[model samples]
Target: MEWDWNFVRQIMPALVEGVKITILASVLGSILAAIVGLAIALARRSPHRLVSRSVGWFAEFIRGTPLLVQLYFIFYVLPDIGILLPPLVAGVIGLGLHYGTYTAEVYRAGIDNVPRGQWEAAKACNLSARQTWTHVIIPQAIPPMIPALANYFISMFKETPLLSAITVLELMNQAKIVANTYYRYLEPITLVGAFFLAISLIAVVLLRWLEQRYGRMEP
Candidate 1:
């Protein structure tokens, strides 16, 4: 097939719509993952051995499993047990959960890097546990962790294509549909690649800026 400028233009709108869905899923998933990761990190640090070990094992299991399998289970398998979710919801959950395990490690590392003296100082001041974490620990830990978290956000964006397996109309899924409908693979697939490359390059530049701004402040 000759390069079809007309077809490319025709498909652009749908592809752009798909791009919006892709970005939405990534942003929402990243937010959920950040929250879940912090919870896991904190739970793993609990004074109770059972709490810590169980959270540790859960994190390990999630990290060890394939994301695709997790997606399938969330979207397909759970319905058998009466938990039905929309495709987008299932995909978001799968992405958040799979990446949350990795982010938990990043959180753990950041939390660990906080100076022991900070903890001692909080104790000396008789600060409550909540006040210490709020005022001292998290503020110190989060900045250095920003660049790493941004990298994972970018990774989650790339992985949005996998949501197609569960029927979410992300970029790759839209591209496949466009190609199938028009019987022209070249333009749609190439455009999908171009879109991903453009976004990824932009994210890389932002990641670099974040690293420069926060990495040097590491304690």
Candidate 2:
């Protein structure tokens, strides 16, 4: 079938609305993942062997599994145990947790890259552990990690389409609905691809800027 401008116009509002949800999920999920990843990274570095090993093993399990399976468990399986979440909440949790394992590795590497002298200096100054991490380690660590974190955010944005499986009305799901309603696959599907491509390219440009701004400052 031929491309139809009128049909495109009709579907644009719905698709735009879907894009908002897609971006919201990605942003919130990224924030949650960063927090979770930082916690996991810190836990794995605990002085206690049991705490460290347990967190390490749990992170590995999350990393080893497929995100789709995780999403299904959160959305479908949880209610069986008397826990229930909205579709969007379940999707956000799934994305955050699945990616948090990977981000934990990024955090580990960033933290490790800090010069050992910095830790020694903090100790020499009699800085408490809290003061040392807050004033020295994380500030130095996070700048270099921004590009990697941004990369994951872009990846999470793309993965938002997977939320469709759980009935979250993200871009791909909205496109699918439009296509089904009109029995026209070309326009809505093509539009979805176009939107994703545009956003991803923009994100890439921003990531490059971040790398240039922060990467060279690394010691």
**Which has the greatest lDDT?**
1
lDDT of 2 by residue, 95-196 (tens): 999889989999999999999999999999999999999999999998999889889889989999999999999999999999999899999999999999
| Residues 1-219, model 1: lDDT tens digits | 788899899999999999999999999999999999999999998999999999999999999998999999999999999999999999999999989999999999999999999999999999999999889999999999999999999999999999999999999999999999989999999999999999999999999999999977965
Could you tell me the TM-score of candidate 2?
A: 0.98
In terms of lDDT, model 2 sits at 0.94
The residue pairs in collision within model 1 are none
* Over 4 Å off, model 2: none
Model 1 quality (TM-score): 0.98
RMSD of 1: 0.8
lDDT at 135, model 2:
98
Q: Model 1: runs farther than 4 Å from truth? A: none
TM per prediction: 0.98, 0.98
Residue 211's lDDT within candidate 1 is: 95
Error of 1 at 201 (Å): 0.8
